[model samples]
Target chain A: MKHVILGNGPTGVVAAETIRKMRPHDAIAVVGDEHERPYSRMAIPYLLEGKIAESGTLLRHDRNHWIDNRIELVEARASSIDADAKSVTLSNGEVLPYDRLLLATGSRPVRPPIPGMHLPEVVSCWTLQDARAILDRLRPGAKVLQMGAGFIGCIIMEAIANAVGKTGGSLTVVEMGDRMVPRMMTPKASALIRSWSEKSGVEVLTSTRVTAIEANVPHAGLLSLVYKAKNTKERVQVTFGDGSTRLFDFVICATGVAPAIDYLRGSGVEIGKLGGIVVDDHMRTTAPDVFAAGDCTESVDFSTGELMVNAIQPNAADQALVAGANMAGGAARTRGGLRMNVLETFGLISTSYGQWWGAEGGDHVEVVDEAAHSYIRLEFQDDRIIGATVVGRTHHIGALRGLIQTGAKLGADWKARLQADPNKFMDAYLATALSLA
Target chain B: MMNSLHIDASKCTGCLQCEMACSYENHGVFATSKSRIKVFDFHSTGRKVPYTCTQCAEAWCMHACPVGAIHEDKALGAKVVNETTCVGCKVCTIACPFGTINYVADTGKVQKCDLCAGKPACAEACPTGAITFVDASWTGLDRMRAWAEKLDTNAPTA
Candidate 1:
């Protein structure tokens, strides 16, 4: 039977590998838009920081390896699908018949429609082409201006600062939000990040919003940023969004990425409200023989039981395993996957998993460091550890991860551990259990 | 003879064991971003490359320094930067083509991969065998072995 999988990203690749392991004899084909072998998407910033060389971070296996395992890899864009006929067409007009198909078309970076966005220097981060294009503009003494302060944006600013600053180039990051990494960290955690950036020599502008981008010319060699700071009525040319209108050689908008699903629209496949393909518990799509996984599909959060879009590598890997197992006639269910993110920003390992987050909650606790720049806050409801953010010396990050994953409820005495060292917080788990019993 | 650390990026899995290893060794913490070794991702090309200081034979960073702060370590043959003497001028940063040499504003020193004083943590922590420490003379031995496998003079014809 012909089984086709779309996209060679984490989820699609894992699904292909899993299916082959489950049924060795089945005819399997993998379709990918990218011509190169599947590599890790999470390592993009490190590449910019000059940490690794150009080709050092390849995936575990290559296309040749997959072919050796009896899996056909189609290196082309998949444009449309015919669910009724059980087939999908590539951009080259090649149609392949399939008994089963899985959609793993991942996310694209969200590019805001600001003026002068079509300029050569202003670009967003996502695919390899985007990275290489940015690299071309990164000459010695060339200034870099970054827009956005989310996880990818914040991390790349550090990378760009390190890379450009090494070459005598100036670097600045402009963030519209009052705090950086709003989705991943709380205000206390963001405070730690702000301090770390100060130490790293990266000038960050928070509580500032960019209103327009202009291609500075005569040379067309630099870009100017127009922004307005919070609690101010003035529209200023704060070169990097602070009252300093500086010329920059390159401008990278590391805003964010959304799932790529334009191909699945007319196929009668159910799409999620958040722009991802809809899938059930087993990662099976509404179409009988079609399955989907990765950033392109919606998933249920393990703790909240709420439908959410999680386009990270870990979730894709786990979901792919389930999709592949069921595709091969094995009894594997996704159950649900947690949204886990682990990032090293400035010099701290910032992380968020499951529903260890939410903007609105009645129960919460705030902790901070006045001098050393550290912060940790645990938000709870009904005595269960619902969410937490640890900033500066977060020693037992794993313990929080464990508590969130297991839905463990904490006793009142556990609050005392906040005064104790973070590393010693794990020791409080048992004492709290004892006191409550 | 001082030996330079060699990297093989093709085998990297982006597991970050190398970065963790380096951070733990240098700062007694686990932070990949602060580590000397960095991994770059070419997402569309599906490439992740781990890069660090090549420790050039004729080091430009050493020559570019005004106060002779950057020097060569005889034991590991690494270009070492004396943090105490560095003025954080970043002149060497401009001279280096690869941008391996970086200024750390926190300590007011320039930081680069020192090969961990000859025992490189990145090479040790690489789980996929992508990086390994070897003598200065035999860096091309792996490539030779790969080519040697292709010789089929006496092989049975399939």
Candidate 2:
């Protein structure tokens, strides 16, 4: 048997190893477009923070890991897939035949349609190359402006803040949403994060949008001509929607990302409404012998019976396991994708699980202590916890996940007790789980 | 046959000897906070449950690691973290459902139970036999045997 995997990210690397372990005699090839060794995008933030070198971002540390595993690494972009012919055509004009195929192309940052977005000063913090460019421009007292405060945006903000904090530089973050990390956090939770960021020396502006970015050319005047000679370094003038402008040495756009499935347009695989490849419990696409996983694929959401792109590394690893097993002529099935997000912004840890926003008409409870910067909210459907959001507490927070994932019924008495004091989640979980056992 | 750490929560005394032993074995420290195995004190229920890495067959932390820093120790059947290769992203801490893997701020690396390569210190240091290193295939043998002794074939049906 021959296997060809696309997009040598975490999903591809894991799937390739799984296949090799299951069927060692089978020929396997992994395709990656990047020049660097197969690396994890999740580690890019650490690299930017100077906590680790570029080699630390690699998915496998050893240089000869692929060779040792007997997996072939092909450096090429997949141009198209011919499902009917059981072959994939590469951009380098090579046709590779495969008995099984996996599409884990992952996601790419979306460049919003704003004027001067292509300027060298404006870079999306997505790839290694982009990290290099941003690092090159960073200096002592360098003023940086970043657009977007979503999950990815906040991660990049932390690295940049740390880099600039030591040198007394300035960092301003703009988010069009009403609150920072609006998608992953509730209003109260996001507000607390904003304050924390502010306290940590990051100027956060919400409900703001950058309208345009233009090369900063000093105003044509005698004083401007004199200032231009002193300031030889090029800067960008950013215009906000409210007609406000600011000059920044570098602009980072982390607006959002979408699945890189454009190459699957002609293929028979189905694409979801959110622009992700659609797959079933087995991680198999609509087309036969084709599988997809990772941020590029949409699977059933365990909390809500809907298909969603839960683009987290854990989900990708789970999906890859099932996909690789089935691809190697074994049977496997996934319960579904569960939404999980744990983020640390400026030393403040926050997390959400399952349908964290709560199901419609569901009962919920909140325990907030604004002074201590601690908050815990539990969303309940009947006697079972369906979702949770917590901040400023890390010890045994995984108990919340245990309660939500098991969908354990807290019983009427326990439910009321928890409603009164949401911090008793550990007790509730232990009671329910222990009783069930 | 490989050996596995078997935990008996019912016999736990909450002395925290296992925790101190684990920390000292791995980090050359006596701090309980740095221990890979933890004893949870249920103040309300008056029960202490000691928990650590189960060393799953398909270890989630090992597979979810983007840097492949977590590897299986073939000799001990333990999942060990290579600190030098770890980038301290803390993804493994999330991937672990048991919450046994933890990040150390001092080193910026995640730590978990590696069964002391083969002879686990927690099992050796346990006072009440709450933790023990036993054959992997028969981790439940003692419990099964205890129950078997209770089922007398000659006992009359009530």
Candidate 3:
């Protein structure tokens, strides 16, 4: 069988390898739009931080990894898919026939509708090219203005902070939400993160929005015209929604991201309301013989029982496995996508799993120590833990994940004990999980 | 035949020899904090349970690794992290359900049990036989045989 996979991100790479392992002789081709070797976008922050070279971001260190696995790498963007003909047409007009197809075209950064947002001084920290542009602009004492404080935003902020900390630069982060990481963290948790970032010398402004950006001329009147003519130093004057302006060396928009599915408009595959391709438990889309995974697909949410996009790496990998196996004429199913996010911002680690925000009618318990910068909140539904949010502590925390994933019942006595003191979760987990085992 | 590390928690003495041995084998150090395998001291029940990477068939750390830093060692059937490629993002440390993979602050890289490339220093250092490297397929054989011996079918009476 011939398999054609789109988007050489982690999901596509993993699915291609899975197919190769299962059906060794099957012809496989992976299509990537980027110029660089297939690399992980997750490592872009590390690259910006000077933690690793560009080559270190490559998915496989071995030069012949793809060739050794007998998988072909096609460097081209997919234009459209002809489901009836079982063919995919590349932007370069090359047509490839396939017995199976996977759509793992991950996500693209969402560019908000702010005036002058498309200027060269502003870039989204998503791709390798973007990283290079940001790095070039980031000089000693550069004034960096970052938009958004969500998961990706916080990661980029941390990297930029580290980079600028060496040169005595300044970073100002603006978020529209009331707290940082509003989507993934609770209010109290986000407040702690904001304070942590502040303590690290990063100026974080929540509940703020940038209204407009304009190329800044050094002087406003006649001198400004002369300065514009010989504008060697590039800077932008950003207008805030509150009628205030600030000058920045460069602006980074990590506002948000959406699934890169514009090319699939005419395709027979069904796009869900969540703006991702809809797939079943087996990862099969509406189009016959076509599967979708990664950040581009809306799978079942384990907590809410609704189709939602849990666009984290672990979920992407799990979905890719199922898609790859089923595409290779094997049976595989996901237990539904679980929302998991673990982040380290300025050396403070925090994690949230499942429905971090408590479920409807669920009993919730929280233990917070502001001075110690430690907090733990457990959301319980009936006698089972459905979600959890933890900050500061990292040892054996996976037991929280273990209990949630296993969906084990704590019974009455254990439940009351946990409610009283959530720190005893490890003991509770050992007791309950062992009994179940 | 592939070999696996089998643990008998009941026989553990919490001497931490396995931890010291593991750290020395991997890091050329004697620091227990640097060991890949850790012995959890349950102060309440006074039970010490030694736990480390199970080297799962479908390892979460290997899959969750975006840069492909973690790979299966074909010879030892161990999932090992390539430090050169690891960005120290600590994503694998969180993905691991058992919390066996750890981030080393000194190196900024994650470390896990690689079974010492099949030698298994922990198993070799155990004094009470709480840990042992045995055939993967028959890890439960000794216990099974022990229980079978208790049946005493030759007695011919209850």
Indicate which candidate wins on DockQ: 3
Candidate closest to the true structure, highest lDDT:
3
TM-score of chain B of each: 0.82, 0.86, 0.85
lDDT of 3 by residue, A56-148 (tens): 899888999988999899999999998889999999999989999999999999988989998999999899999999998887677899999
Assign candidate 2 its CAPRI class. incorrect
| DockQ, every prediction | 0.02, 0.21, 0.24
Which regions of candidate 2 deviate over 4 angstroms?
Answer: A166-168, A219-221, A413-417, A420-430, A434-437, B43-45, B141-158
User: For residues B110-134, could you state the per-residue lDDT of candidate 3 as single tens digits?
Assistant: 8999998889999999999989999
Question: Per model, how much of the real contact set is kept?
Answer: 0.00, 0.26, 0.35
TM-score for each candidate, following the candidate numbering: 0.67, 0.93, 0.92
Model 2 lDDT tens row, B1-158: 88899888889999999999999999899999999888877775788888777786657689888888999999888999999988877777766655668877678678889898798999999999999999887576444233322311111111
* Residue A386 lDDT in candidate 1: 60
Candidate 2 lDDT over A250-270, as tens digits, reads 799999888999889888889
